[model samples]
Target: MKVSIFFKVLCVVSLIFLAGCTQGSAGTTVEDSVSLSMESETKVDETEKFNNDVDNNSEENGDNALKMLVNWKGLFYNPMVCSPYGCYEIMNRTDYTGNILYTDVVTRQRIFLSPDLSADHNNSSDPSWIDNTLGGCFLFTMDDTLFMSRYNYEDTPGELYCMDLDGRNRQSLVTFTDYNAPEGGIASDGQNLYMVLYKQDKQWLVRVHIDSGKIEPLKEMGGDAAFLTSAYGDTLVLKEIRAENTDSEDQMESYLSQIHTVYHYNITDGIETEILSWQQDKLLEEYSGEYLYLLDVDKESLKEVSLSTGEERMVIDALSAESINAEEIRSLYPIYDNHLIFDMGNDEGELKKMSVNLDNGRIFSIDPYTESLDAYGSQYLGIVGEFGDEFLVTSGTLEVPMDGIDPDGNPMVVDMVMSKLSVIKKEDFWNNRFDAMEPVEDVFLESMD
Candidate 1:
């Protein structure tokens, strides 16, 4: 059960802080401000009062209602996709075209949802034209708008679209062979929308109402394969996966053993329940809000379960907190409201970040005082912002190391990981407030030849 191993430990700490940059760009983009304008734009009114004071999102007014959630660092994954009405990047023009570069977390404006959106456009048959989203696309957000599909997973009919978190009303929203042809991708609990279709080869579970878009189906599974993952209220969570074939002769073993299970279907009455089945060496690691955390790498403990009373507790045990010892957990950041950010390895191994307090196991050490952080801070946060609920807009990556010599002269160095998109606060992180962080330095004069 290593699925999403915390997004593979935040993608191996963003590939050791971008040391392989576009080997899948792990966050960083800024400066597309494009001469800001849209009426006296003092940088979108300094991020428009963090989206116009929704009572500072309350965690006792310290921040909570998810201040327009970019939480889990604006998830969508890969090449970027943050929202509260800004931050959508994915660029590369040659090596098989691609483009979609927006950015406006409050008027630091920059556009490219097409050869011109908010600007040029003679409609090259617009479906958000840029040669029709240049072959690959997937940016999402369900009921609150902003979508761009066409990153299809085969079986044809695929296509869905939406917009208006400032990117205007670009339409087109139906066609997965007109509903119930899904292939595991999409889930929502904000009034319905959950999928996993297949039909003749069996596998349904549809549901799509959000104001009557109607699309039904409801339940059938039994052949396994599921996988969608999150959706609360009246239930939806999934994951089936099975695999076999292992006569291991140990070379670090693993010729195949998977298993996995985790259930929860019930969109009103399809009942499916189950909550957690595994394969051992535990790791599961996700599905926040109603809990399901897990992690037990050789017993350095940390768990949660209870996706609805499968019970199970113990959060952090291998020498329990005081600045960390879940085996110096090298990285696990992102768990907003119940707090929980991670990264440890002191004792001169440097890797900082740490925050914990998952309902009061208290433990802090985010040392904020950024002059663009790096007196050995290594970076890996995420939220990237303009009043991100009021401060803590993250995205990070920085690992510089350069020394060289060849041809008979010896000495080498090369670690260089640069890509950041910062914005942290709360006294710039509990009172260390120098510049209070804002690492947006921009780069991508386009590459991938």
Candidate 2:
């Protein structure tokens, strides 16, 4: 059986997502707020239930406004998104059960965005993962509206939603009962939302009209595992992972050399323009600009390519002090706050994160475990979202040797579990301010054990 741990499996490049026509109105009554405040000093047993207070209404803009909708949120670990006011996260959800919380960054005041959505959680066979045959922030936003398609990986249906930033004027857009979308299969243009969805056997690029709430299928994705990365201007970047023959006797070695292709797919017409193609051995990252970044493990160089002009600039190489042992690099992510992040594996194949500063072309290591120990007494899993120069991340409470053991014996773990969602400023993190991270006290959806 293949198990996908929420943290290490999710990979993405950085984004400038919010791209949509400013249209749409918020409706519906302002729902009541149900607050479930946890005792920050108390420790709950693993079996103790955490309550969700989803008593109101709210929404997202269009889908494209998100830098990493499905990618940013660790949909399975700690689903979160940030707005100018603060950040909204699917909190207190464990085992696919939770509610949304809006926490003000400046005031730390909290509110609810949805009612207990535990019943709505898609508990598929693979309960904790998205069906990204390929995968972020799981929801996207337009000006003040939110759009989300809820689905898990198996043969489940997906329900689309549109809402306001405050959880008011929410709309149940549509439901893909016949198809479920991989989280990365979502994007937006002007006023429409685009998605990649598949049923039992095949995949296709689909579109959703914001005003009419219409579902439109535009193109077919071949049988290979495919998904979208982000959208820019009138085009969405599409990527596909194809199997390549490496002329090696070992099948596993061939699988390691996966082929990847990225294209600028125009939303106006069904046109696809090739941008770059490389093997899985390379890493790709580009932030808000018209440039695409790559960590060429094979060439032992870091390259910056202009999307419009196809100009490639060498940023790092074997001779540079930032030189990396290409074979040991596992994965790379999009630039966030001008820092290019990548994962490098140790001799035992354990992955650790490293950061590259584009301005200075200097390298720094991001030790999530040590960082977590300083803040949550847990292990940092992945990033949740970026809000006001700060980032909210998910960190797992250290697991007991035997999960079925009594959970009450560990108060420190319990406190960390309650506040598993931690927030740290991008500047603080870059400066290695691990102690500066503060935990958000959203309860778990289920037992951590």
Candidate 3:
């Protein structure tokens, strides 16, 4: 609530400044002069000083310090759907014929394509439920072809469809009759597609050739499996049940209740590398290109492991334990320019971003808001999807100010303004253009709180 108040004041000042500059020559209004004076009076030299101190502190520590800027804002879309190559946005609105809309991020031009497949796989009683068919993970190949895994509850074997970028030629790659395809099953490497299938007793990770319908077992990890990360080139990371404890065995004595291990499988060589292991004592927070970062609850320290050498290092200790009363580490993610963003859970069970630090351990806080007081609890203000230098962040009570932007750009705000989607430029964030003044620091702080 305090953070919200700060944002409100900041917004009022910004609006007054913009109004005075625009209407000064037309007429000498008393309100305009007052607004200008108010803007000047609210300019806290201390705020700029604090920012300067942070910048200086970072520079003194290391030259590898990341320079961050908040550039543009728009609705956060899945990053995998964009970037490296390029991607088009697809929204499933419950209006009209339910067409798929595509837009180029660079040019901001809208490109319309015919619906490759109908949303109604099964003509259900509710039309809204029929539109659920559009929901699934999609990956575009280097050759500019779109591949998607569609789920059909009615049939035994669901479908994997491949279509031209413009939704032209369509073909079904493979259908699995024995095993149901998991959601977000397909991960591709331009040559082959990997799909995770959930069987009765064990989980199987299968690879299917894109060109041919040939399917083969990549690796079968016993127990439940959840998708974690993709190495982009050839490796896939999966979280699998390494060991399980049963009631027949001594449950109290056995330390291994449920251990989640991150395994890297090379699709090309068919090699499974046990890069990192997490037991009840240690937990993984996030992973970058070469490092797997974990939070040790028992030790109260942030740990990192090199994926190549299997060497572990303690980076930082959770010193401010009393101030936040954090019970567990909620979310750990990597930001652009190689910064680690971590969230900690408070006594109320709400999670907030605690710190943004580099691999070497220089830390900074972006606290601007108080944690929302709601019975249901607050959701994470995550950098859900990213592309190039930009990423999408969803925030607030209603997720009202959901926008995507490069945080390392000049002040430009792209106001989605409670619409289905809107674009905010870099200038808006820097200039404080929105009526809603959610400061970047405040956004981060609220997340941590």
Q: 3-61 in candidate 2: lDDT tens per residue? A: 11222112212121110011112211113211111221122221221111010011123
Candidate 1 on 329-440: residue-level lDDT in tens?
A: 6656435444556666757876666565656555677645222334444444443333323343445543433343434666554333434455445445544453555444
lDDT for 137 in candidate 3 is 28
Task: Say which candidate scores most in TM-score.
Answer: 2
Distance from true location, Cα of 428 in model 3, Å: 9.8
RMSD of candidates 1 onward, in order: 22.3, 11.1, 15.1
CA deviation > 4 Å runs, candidate 2? 1-78, 92-97, 109-111, 114-138, 152-156, 245-250, 253-257, 282-289, 349-351, 368-378, 381-383, 393-423, 438-449
Better of 1 and 2 by lDDT: 2
lDDT of every predicted structure (CA atoms): 0.46, 0.50, 0.40
Model 3: runs farther than 4 Å from truth? 1-80, 84-90, 93-98, 107-143, 184-186, 226-228, 232-234, 248-256, 311-314, 318-326, 365-377, 394-449
Error of 3 at 25 (Å): 30
What lDDT, from 0 to 1, does candidate 2 have?
0.50
Native-referenced Cα lDDT, model 3: 0.40
Worst window of 10 by summed lDDT in candidate 2: 49-58
- My TM-score estimates for the predictions, one after another, are 0.31, 0.67, 0.59
State, as a TM-score between 0 and 1, how close model 2 is to the true structure. 0.67
